[model samples]
Target: MATDDSVHPEARGLEVVIRTAPMPADANGNGDIFGGWILSHMDIAAGVLAAKRAQGRVATVAIDAMTFLKPVYIGDLLSIYGEVVGVGRTSIKVRLETWVERQRRRDGSLTARQSMRVTEGTFVMVAIDEEGRPRVVPEA
Candidate 1:
């Protein structure tokens, strides 16, 4: 995938955990993608990393911080990148960023795609067992 050179320095080298484009159904009446949709995607990406690190099931317990840097429009390819920033006995913290490669009409023609950072958040996930109770996170 093509990347923008202007992305945050800290966002560099993070693993791209999820990449998907939003459909019209994912947008609000104002034609912008819903915040919940983006948040859900972030959560899913965090869960994937957390599960891998935990070596088992994991559940999102909290979103410690989330900032919407820009609006997401339909047809923009959203890519979520994540990394395991912290780990505890039973919880893990994942830092995630969502970037969008956008296509827009310019001068009645499609402009060259440009990538931009849209949202970022830190997700807190807890390792879980088969019964859905918190469990110790295995050592990596």
Candidate 2:
């Protein structure tokens, strides 16, 4: 999985599910963006896709094969991209990838930036009924 994640560049053509930058409060003791923050965004991205596919409410069932490939900094512009990789009776498996564009210098300019993948994960989202029970995933 590391090889697959490392070989790919920024996810182009795939849907840009969420795009935002980290703040100082989002950083960890090491000065890097906290892993949980990235994981939450990935879940949100996957949920967006999953809900659309299910055409209704959905819940996160599991997060599989989560990988942190690189560190995200406070100023980096984070982009979370998602793709629906699989669908079942009530579950949708989404592949989520996060990339960060870092400012090249202290000038805080976007003109010169570096983009790299920092995290990738597969989130399993399940279509749910109003009662919170698993429901059939509708056909697209």
Candidate 3:
């Protein structure tokens, strides 16, 4: 059975996730949104929080528990949200959740309310110094 929890939206404690529409350039020959595109968005969301916490530059060291629940099509609006799940000496784990919204029919009879949940990945980012070496994260 396919597990929906892989990209469960409620997993990440996000107040407001940003929404963006997928363009033709983002899709593959089959017209499905490329996984890389979604991952990049998640990284961007995570980076925003990571930079705020590190107070400097940060690099992605690892991604944990990533799974693609459904294929995304062009014109679909994507939403991604992230939360700082864990913090180490120099690393922070950000849990990200992604969702998609598609347009309904002209009659507004509920065309598609599908929640793909693209993936839930824990991004490990390390704080970096001016020289790019890992530095201790500041206390919250």
Measured by TM-score, the strongest candidate is 1
Model 1 regions more than 4 Å off? 1-5, 8-11, 105-109
**What is the C-alpha lDDT profile of model 1 across 9-125, one tens digit per residue?**
245779999999999899888788999999999999999999999999999999999989889987788999989999999999999889898887422357888888899899999
Against the true structure, candidate 1 reaches a TM-score of 0.90
Cα deviation of 105, candidate 1, in Å: 4.7
Best by lDDT: 1
Scored by CA lDDT, what does every candidate get? Answer: 0.88, 0.84, 0.76
Residues 1-140 of candidate 3 have per-residue lDDT tens digits of: 12355455555356334679888899888788899988888888888878878888999888876778777777677888677878899998887777777664323355656555666677889999999999999999
Residue 67 lDDT, candidate 2, scale 0-100: 90
Sorted on TM-score, best first, the list reads 1, 2, 3
Count steric clashes of candidate 2: 0
